[model samples]
Target: MSALQAVAKTSAPTPEYYFQEARAFFDAFKASQAIISYRKSLLMTPAAPQALNNLRLLEQSIGRMPDGVKSATRACVLEPGNTALQHGLTDALLSAGEIEHGQARNFWRHLKPEILIIRQGLPEEWNGGPCRDGQSLLICHEQGIGDEIRFASCIPDIQKRFGGPVILESDKRLATLFARSFPGLTVVEKVQRSDSNPPTAQYRPLVEEHGIGRYIMLADLQSFVRPSLEAFPRTAGYLTPDVTETRHWKDHFRATGKQPAVGLSWRSGMRRAGARHNYPELQDIVPFLKGADFLPVCLQYDMSSSERTAIQKASTKQLYIPAGIDQRNELDRVAAMIAALDLVISPNTSVLMIAGAVATPSIGLHSERGATFLGAKTDPWFPEECSLIKSGDGSWSALINEAIPYLTRMLSKGGRLK
Candidate 1:
């Protein structure tokens, strides 16, 4: 008998065997195979906690949040005491647009206070309850700069509802931008730095010095501000660019005599393995750029020498990269450049967020697995100005093919077409 047949003949294979196979497949990046194996294991051993949890994670990694929610919910039921499973379920539910679920709030119960601390002096933590007017509320930012940008959409709404002085503590890099973006609020820098961990005591001054009356985390703002889809901020371009920088870029691009200056950012800088799926090869977008009336501008922050060379060779049309403009540290310049563009085509990243927030008529490209892609193919954070286009099964070519016609229509309205 074959070795597989011999093993089957010797003994009935157990769920453990299937689980190990699933893990191996997952390690090899064969997610489809891993999912099959995981399901098979679960079929035999329905209450297997690790298998259920891993399956949920795998599903989410591939942009299957609904499936992930079901798997995580089942896992949480199987292991009722496992806080991690509960957290996973909560995240899946939130991502899948089930924000009204009571269980979603339970995700915060497991958070370490050190991660999101409230000042002891606060009268109470804001938990989807009405905030007293004129009360001072300190908003502690969490997650990433993109998320901070996303949550910042709610500030104007917060101002409208609660007649309070809003204090925002976010990444140090964003303090200046946030200050400019939201005029009325006080913006403070967070304690952590990229190079070193500052003492937690450094953050205390933000609370104590301000005499903040209440506290709320950035994500939690969604509960009160955006309880439903219609509640989202209808205005585009909440952020205002520096007029001097905007004029500089507009003049610089106009000087080139290239009609229809279209901004492009193909890659996201996030280094997580799953996040890598969100970035497509520059060549995938090259064919779309070959057409008339469009001048492609490289908005990628850290384009390497090799990548620049490759992009130069691929784009038949003239592509512009503003000399000495660092998109990473100098968002002021980046915002100005985006303001100068006729349109932007980029993946779901901070680049898209910036473009959307600036009211740029940009096309947001997302991978099949990109978390920024909501089920409706619309981003709640951005206004109608940002058009959402999703790649099927990680196929950037498919996205390009579908987007070219829509892009042509968008360009035809105002941009120069050759």
Candidate 2:
């Protein structure tokens, strides 16, 4: 070996240097680069559990489930008792279709409990339990609104198996629609972010007053309810919007019955690091507004004036927003509006969840490989009406291009795509 080459080898950077490089790449929204740098660091130092865990999150977010599972499994092995790592592994397993394994259920035990409840309610429930009849099951609140709706897919299956009165703690925004849709569930209008600092003081009374004792986080029900692909109900949609409200929105759109009504959501409710990959800019969807076969309606909340003006400039006709409907707070009306539309188009946001729940024909543009996929090619929750275009490497433009055929089919005279 040359003397200069040996000198360069001796000055090679440390694993910690590569680790911090990965974190910076992720924070800058370069997910694929982050994954590569993380792998490089982990190769240099096998004991780096944080690097492994972070890599797993990036891989899974971009639909690389196999890589995600590998990284998560290693992280769990390195730190077996770490709640967050265990949770990460469980989610990786779930997304990789390893449902009945040791770590899939109650993984959120690592997260804070929303509220403490007395043990007297129903003590027999296991890590995974059999259906209990005539008992009360309190479905505790956790995560964002989108997650709540996605997990609610299990509600019907659980109800069928356990003939029990289910009490669901929901975001105040979702309470009305959830109540109307489930009919049987006692809906407590409230919001709680995991077992974290968020308080549930306003809705705790309903649990106590009803003598409800047993509580399960929403996602935990999956271990029993959807343990396998075949277990998911073959239903078009589960949530029922108010009939009159749906009719009202349908008529509002039908007035311009020349073109099909399409609801468009381009962003998430909250933005965070690496979130830009899951959404499109106002300019990105302007082409959709130019489509001749559909009338685009704005379903995006917290939209800026610049985006609104951009939409106005792009479309031959001005883009429409459903009047008097608060897209953020009035979720019941939002559900009805989604139901009324001939088609709904959005990124991997709550709009897709609501559209799926209401049985509306929808095309979802997603980059994140959410556990709701359950390792399937399409969404298992609402397979009949919801079609997902996943840009595995965070290419939203490519995903939008992928939706052309779906649009062509759904907009044709004889095709329902349902």
lDDT of 1 by residue, 198-268 (tens): 21323445666777768877777777877766777666788878888888888888888857788888888
Model 2 C-alpha lDDT per residue in residues 148-239, reported as the tens digit of each score: 99898788777666666778878888888888878688888654324335432343555567665467777677777787889887767889
> Which candidate comes out best when scored by lDDT?
2
State the weakest 10-residue window (summed lDDT) of model 1. Answer: 193-202
User: Residue 217 lDDT in model 2?
Assistant: 71
Enumerate residue pairs that collide in model 1. 134-163
Tell me how candidate 2 scores on lDDT: 0.74
Which runs in model 1 stand beyond 4 Å of their true positions?
A: 1-34, 57-66, 80-84, 106-123, 128-135, 192-202, 368-375, 385-394, 415-418
* TM-score of predicted structure 2: 0.85
TM-score to true structure, per model: 0.82, 0.85
